[model samples]
Target: MIYFYNLLLLILCYLSEINSARILGIIPTPSISHQIVYRPIWKELSQRGHKVTVLTTDPINDSSLKNLTEIDLSFSYDLYNNKHNFSDKIDKLAGKPLEMVNAIITMNADICDEQLKHPKVKRLINDPNEHFDVILVEILQPCMFAFAHRFKAASIGVVSMDAQSAAYDSVVNPTHPILNPDFMLPLAGKLSFFERVFSVVISNVMRVYEFLFIIPINDKVIRENFGDDYPSCKDFIQYLDMLFVNVHPILSGIRPNVPAVVNIGAGLHIQSPKSLPEDLKSFLDNAPSDVIYFSLGSNVKSKDIIPSTRQIITETFAELPYTILWKFEADSLPNQPKNVKIMKWLPQQDVLRHPKIKLFITQAGHQSIEEAIFSHVPMVVMPFFADQEGNAKRIVLKDIAVKVDHKELTKESFKSSILEVMENKKYRENVKKLAELLQDEPMTGLEKAVWWTEHVIRHKGAKHYRSAAIEMPFYEYFLLDVIGFLLLVLFIVIYVSVKMSKLVFKVIFKLCGGEKPKFKRH
Candidate 1:
């Protein structure tokens, strides 16, 4: 048995070494968790004898992998932008994904427009020797699909965020009929008649400007250096053929049925048998038997947690038998509960999988949900924005968890919700059941993603599934006029029938009156 196992391993490694993959870029946002996700797949690719280039501001920080190229994109992902008080302009779009989408489209157009003109970015674009077999683009919103498209390689887009629009495009969570059901084109769910028309107008305006103005300018710049005849990445969709979403369908069950959009999220278990950080392990050693893992995620700071709400959380735990392990950056809580434990950073997956972890209190981000479900732990979700609300509602609807509002949210509401999940037995059972569903995934999400990514490469770019938005007319694609024509015919037939019936009735009335008036057409 041992000899056969060794032989099989050797054959696998030999096969992998021969398959060299050249990845164009991984544009990761500076979030640590999001970065951790990309790390596994990137490392997997490199292990499988692939060359991976990550284009971002995140430096070569971790010493985990080789065959890597890091492009220092001199840019700030700062969301605050020198504002004194945190702005609500962006936050309000949290659960309302379509609003965030419009913002993304506009922002992407602006950023790309600016970056394409920069000397550094321009130089890279002009380089004739920088060709690659595949360009794996991280979908930096407002649509960076064009970025990979520009590189003249087969393009694949990856989303590493739990934001609604991104998750909606990637995962397929079973919706609760009461709270959430099947929605239409937009991530904000189905739009009204007027809203649909408005979306159409907005989409067209942005697209026309992008194609006519933006694409032409970028194309002209490329032509100035690359060659008048060479095609830009924007026009290379048929060439750029596949996409991989870093979402486990168990957590987010949406699967794009299209052949080109391969979602192999079953690979999340590749990093299984979770381990705890040394420091966090020490903290847990000292804490009580019952510990609830509380975190708002990296983007949203817990110290920024409103004091009024914090008091409610503190009081809620005051009555509970279990202690609270909160992830906060601040040194101290004003009125700390005796059972509460605060930490700057957490070994999240490690802790969630811990035997002592009774309940999870989270922002309900997609990745967080994935970790919790994989760990078979229930949660009390306190979502801030984006798809957080939708995620929160999904779990709550599943009878696996509860959600607390960030706006006008009270401590009493927070306390009661937490108590219910902590004390109630059903929440745990439902969560465990959901966990099993997530667990029984076809394969580990990471392996699925890496395998399919290389498969797309091995097959010379899976071109069959690309939507020809650039080629097909909007009307024909959506079939708007087909339905309109049918309705028009129906209306004309109805009108003709009504007119003939009225004529017949008038003739009958004339006959009953025993008199006929001669009428002539002039």
Candidate 2:
């Protein structure tokens, strides 16, 4: 009986141990917005007794989480901010498709180089004994997949936005250019002829761009940092077992996905709004009318906005009776209006949840849109770049928001959009309906993500879940070979039939004493 008890205890401990895993996350991008999408996932896994190590630009240094180890690459942020003014570039690259691709590739390559060279990351990479059950690399930086190969672990991709981007094509199911909008284009469902042509052209161009430029950059960086023995970037991408996309069908539109592509779009990492600071709470509680919250997201500082545009925005808000809460970085604006309030930062999601807040003016970032949808607030979107344009266009198409061109933001146009969105009850209703659909999911995004991460660990890569299409060549995927075979058979039949007819004719001609047709040879 004592021996039996010992065996039972051992079994129980083994069962408990099976639930945990060692997960390595490579989130080299310095953008705070990108970090927000991933931090909750890593935190949840750590809390669940799994060992989680992250090489990140934004590190959560909470001491209490014993299972989590963060290798800080925050220096990448300073390097990026010092080298480039992203706010100014947003305006310049808004409509230029080729330039946008070039800029994004350059930025991602630079960040990847910095992360691979960081001392802590270098040490971890070179350590032969270091191993992980799985490695999670952000999809934006494909070169980071080298870590998965080096660690001999299952690879999972975590994308901050929808999986419609060409960058994700290798890992996800096939994307139709006509049905699915590219990350660069703003058109949505039921596109016109011109739009369809443009979409196809742009899609092909992007694929070429990826092949000729992006992949080479990633390959060079991977070879440099991880050595030549590591697989090429494209080869590393093929080894990805699954992808977690932060997009729900309701917002991102319906598209076919393989089993490996999991949608965790509903989870926005929203916490219960903390008790508001006394002064801010007092200001919100005592608002005379409904409030308008305006923010350009984390990347675009208010001070960097052009002076004329700033004047137009302030003037437009002056006309509104509602209180205007602007997330301005500067301490003071020279001619601030009485109704407007400027803060260096604001708890955006919490503010949106407040009953007095009616409409949100935003840069139409993916996370911000998700937050607004969750809070059932309509928006006035001024899209800047990347997926923001696509997100803004979709919001407008859904009838839950109005769009204002940031470049042409005159006082008249800005105020008119705000007034239209604020006065319209339909916009509010549509957004609330969307919120219902988003919140109706059985599992939170974080819960789903964590469960899958453990699932991969438990199964040791979950290779069974991989799609057959991942191994298929472009011609095979489209069945061009099968089609060619059918065409060849038809040609043979026609050739044989023509020859038989000619022979029959010649026999008949000879029987009837008719001359056979003579052929002239060159």
Candidate 3:
């Protein structure tokens, strides 16, 4: 009996050891902000004993985590840095929705092609012994979905921004143009007649553009890399088990979401702030008054700003009593203000946590906005492109930030916006209230994401959680068939009514001895 009990214990231990899975993460985008959102997810899975293989531009090379395997695609980053003029593109693409979409699609295609051609990725693809239980892909680049299909793995999508319009198609959710506006358009709630018409028309145009142009390019790339035997991008979308989006009801307005859609917004990257470096701490501690933290995020380098705009910013800062800590990439700035301190980079989260930090001057990127909200720091936004404009408008609408168009920025305007936010305590109060609501969730975003990911792996694609909308055609989903039936019934009723009236009229005319009306056929 003793021997049998020991044998049973050993068998249970063995089962536990083999329970962990091999997770594959494909994040080929060169954008650092995107890397920031995805890195933590794979890292957490690795920490929990799953073997994680990540192909990314930014690799968190922690030697301590034995389960993590990061394939460095920093070469892609180098290519983008050397070849692309981001500042100019941002300037030109602002408010041009179609052009912006085209630019992203083209850029992502180039990156995806380069990623597939890399030797490490090629070897992984060719290796017959390799296997994964689940594959996590960046949702922006749909071409990468082929990897999930090829590996025969359960697929989970990661979006660094709010659930975009294109993502609705994957889960088969209704993308009502007015209710769920495209990320490019800065629209929310109750639009005027002209605005509503424009919204519907533009939204449909974008959908057509994606279908006609973007999907074909994606299909071509997948076929070239993975071969024609593989399923098309649309076919592979059905394999997606869940999508983790960086959206919160508190930050982004509440919208209808399918069961497979998970909102891990502020919690996606927000963690306990680490201790600031000594020099940075000293700088903040020594400040005479409250400091304003300024950064345009990693993608938008401060040096890229036009000289005149830079001068206007400097002049505005010089007028303020608050100290300014700017994330300027350059070694030095000409005519730098006495109160302004420039650094190539600063620990943003740590700085935001400081009590003396009064305001954040930001580009209003999703990640930056999340950080600001997490820290209860109000913002003065100068939005540039992509979702930044929408994010800025949302923050402004929430009454937690002031929006200053970068193109219209001047010393006076910049100074006034800053002063307005600083003087008004309501902005600070609103942000703090929002932070409380965000923190009040039942489970942290990270926990929810991990739970859902592991659930998919364990259940072999968690089909029960999938929305019923996926099985319905577009007409069926909107009950257009039902509408058609009602219309048909109405037509029959009208026809019957007209015939009855004509018969009654004829009888009445004959009874009254009236002349019959003559009908002419042309």
lDDT of the candidates, in the order given: 0.63, 0.85, 0.86
Q: How would you encode candidate 3's per-residue C-alpha lDDT over 1-522 as one tens digit per residue?
A: 999999999998788668889999988888888898877788789988889999889899899988999999988876567656555677778778778778878878877888898999989888889999999898888889998878889998888888677776788766778766777787765678887898899888987887899888889899988888877787777657888888886677677778888888775887677999999999999999999999999877789888888889998999999999999999998899999999998888889999989899999999998898889899999988888887888889899999998887888889999999998999999999988988888888888888989999889887788888788898998899999999999999999999999999999999977987778999
Alpha-carbon TM-score of each model against the true structure: 0.75, 0.92, 0.94
What's the candidate order when arranged by decreasing TM-score? 3, 2, 1
Candidate 2 local lDDT, 162-241, one digit each (tens): 86465457665768888887866887878999999999998888888888998899999999999976778888887788
- Alpha-carbon RMSD of each model: 6.9, 4.1, 3.5
Q: Which TM-score value belongs to model 3?
A: 0.94
Better of 2 and 3 by TM-score: 3
- Tens-digit per-residue lDDT, 408-522, candidate 1: 6776787788788888999889877877776675567676777778777887676555555425565865678898898999999999999999999898877879566668999
lDDT of 1: 0.63
Look at candidate 2 and give me any clashing residue pairs.
none
Per-model tally of clashing residue pairs: 20, 0, 1
